[model samples]
Target: MTDVVVPATGYVIISASPDFSCPDSRRYYRDKGIMQGKTVIYGDIISAEERRAMKKGFAGKLANLVWRRDKTLFAPDESCAAVFVDLDDPRFANPEFLVSLATAGEQVRVIGKSDRNDIQDTIKVSKLGVAEVLTSEQCLTRLHDLLNEVEEIATASEHRDTRYTIDALIGSSPQIKEIRKTIRLLAEVDFPSALILGETGSGKSLVSRILHNTGLRGKHNLVEVNCSAIPDELFESELFGHVKGAFTDAKNEKTGLFEFAQEGTLFLDEVGNLSPSAQAKLLKVLEDKKLRKVGSVEEKDISVRVVAATNVDLHEAIRAGQFREDLYFRLNLLTIEIPPLRQRPEDIRDLIEYYLNQFAVLYNKGTIRFSENAIEDMTAYAWPGNIRELCNVVERAVLLTHRDEITAKDIRSALKRGRITAAERRQLTIELPPQGVSLEDVQAQVIKRVLDMFNWNKTEAARYLQISRPRLRRIIQAAGLEQNRRRP
Candidate 1:
């Protein structure tokens, strides 16, 4: 007999035989050896026919019944033991035993074995203890309980996937590196209610996720709610939950974001967009860690780490009286201010390379690289929309790159179609002055401006001037342009 660890003290023999159709039995077989384990519901059911078969060897002996390793059912020196269960047993109706086993594989132990006999091998069950029989109605009542539990476990797991993966945080810039280090340091503390202030597309939501996934409650819930996305009428119901019939359309009771994020993290994206009333309600929740469901008298005391993000300036909003000052202070516990992409201009190249590689493999394209001019143009314009804009640019370039290298023409074409507004365009003019700045100085400025304008193109700038690479190099050296116009 194979050894099976007991999860709970019930149902020792789970039906192993495919033929046995007992709904309660987990597996079915004869148990070998002495009663060496814990006291629980267990035994081998020896049917009357099998008992008759035990007396004399026959063509239809228990050996015929055994279906394991190729040995006769039992040795001549061994005697088989048997216990018989009724066709109907009450224990099958109770759910406490089955649910624990099915979910955690806890609260039960079961096994199976078979012995040789002469008359005929038949099915049986051994009852180890007395249990009240549950009616067929009872079993039917909770028939789907186990399946529901399994499904819920699966869905919850899916909803809460990826608490902390570094890939989710998008950059390798020095600023990003510093943020990473800060997160590592903060993971050691109990800092609560952090505010992630930044422009849109600056990856505030991503940073919130990083904090939740890497912090103390990594194994717990990390629920996200978009404040701006929730309708005004339903804001309370969405965040603090609502009782059935709380409003005209509130036909059924509903759980809210606070309940879902209890004892874990609540990422309120666009928290600054909350209306005046919502702001008040949210402030109350933050102060008291308690919320009363709409149309209900009862209140729930919650414990959650609040992480709020916003594209709007809360300080400005507060000055304009659009946001509450007290609430702003509450949310500003450990503020992380993410500058717009244009401000952290040094990071564009790395982001370009990262996103290009990501999209190239995703779109099943050959290896791709940005031409010098293409890189320059990207860096030149102020990315008002920041990394988010860069991402869109890179994605489009990867899809449209006919050649392996993404050239200036491709970028200009994409931009011409409105990747950027015409008003934002700044053309690089590399003319040497008549009595102007030294040729070297002019070359340096021209190259730097062109690099920033076209996003850093050696060839495009050279071509624009109708010059060759060697000649361009001499001019670059004479002008000391290399020190000023390199792309990191």
Candidate 2:
């Protein structure tokens, strides 16, 4: 006999075989009264053919199935949210077939009738991915508890996945769809190394965390290291550890990042900035999967998956002899290039809404809304700093705006006070005096104007002009306008 509950519809019982009787099972659920006022079909009144037809009829409507192993027959084509199996029955003795029935996203519970060594059998069955194991004495209460817990978890998981997962990436653009697909595919694979390349603030770090948190190594530690931030002299020691008395500061034997992330993941941020010596050491470790402490002759084997991210182009650095080609190849086994914000403007509105909601809850404030004009301006603006800049803008607007609705003026003020580039602030317009103007003269004039605007501060001027200070200096020199400095 099989008892099924079609969630939100009603409960029903179908007896599949007349020869196999389960009066105790029927009486147990009937006394519980959970299935009162539900439909019941008797196998004695219906033929075997009629039972098969009924099973096929209710296939799509069923949400969960609870079967008595001795009396119930297996319906290979039927599937449900959860399945309960009587482990004491000889017909359901094959653990492999029971596991196969569980499948992905489906729950299976094994119930034992005897107390003899059932705990050991439960442990063995759990290894095959059975969700829960219980004795028949505790079966009713445990089953009810398990169902409630599973329902709550399923609801929360759905909500969380919609908010923070790759699905929450929030874009309908082709580039974003491709990224989502790539992330899904990569999550399924067991690749050891992956490289994430993008501009600063383009969510490379977010991607790294998602990959580790959702992948097989999710349960283990995920160690992150900023290669550009570490000093060149301490790079090897910091990454590979050192023995006690290995150097002046080496008073204790230290565990390196590799050992810390053993059987897990190690994320190297800004990996393209590693020094030549550090790169060689990293390459050796990647090649051999082993490392030695600074003063120790013993080499320890590591089983760490590497995830490297860089805003700088490693290929260009390699061409300039600033990054190692071999290390690049090793880390670049699987590459995911994130498109800049400007390339996916359709996602800007969704991102703005998401951050607004996030910050509203974080700051314990009421819900905030954005004016149409504000959304228009934000969507049209070129976010050179990408999602990071947008988040800052939203945070500042939320904190500073007095009204619940943010207008374009609020966005503009936030941008101006934050980091508005000259291109975003003012459009340069040049009108020739009926006579053609020298391109160099125009360039020199613009450069002088920017320098004077920032009080002759080359660093600030370069930032406003969206160029490096060295590049700004070269432009000033080429234009022969070095003497046009404003005294502070």
Q: Pick the candidate with the highest TM-score.
A: 2
Model 2 residue 226 lDDT?
68
* Model 1: residue 87 alpha-carbon error in angstroms: 56
* Model 2 lDDT-worst window of ten: 9-18
Please, what are the lDDT tens digits per residue for candidate 2 over residues 2-112? 212211100101111110123553454334333332121111222354335334434433234343324343354333344455555555556665556444222222233
TM-scores for every predicted model: 0.54, 0.56
Can you write out model 1's per-residue Cα lDDT over 222-312, one digit (the tens) per residue?
6666675455665777678788988875666867767766666788888888899989989998998889999999988988899999878
- Please report the candidate that would top lDDT against the real structure: 2
Off by over 4 Å in 1: 1-164, 167-172, 418-488
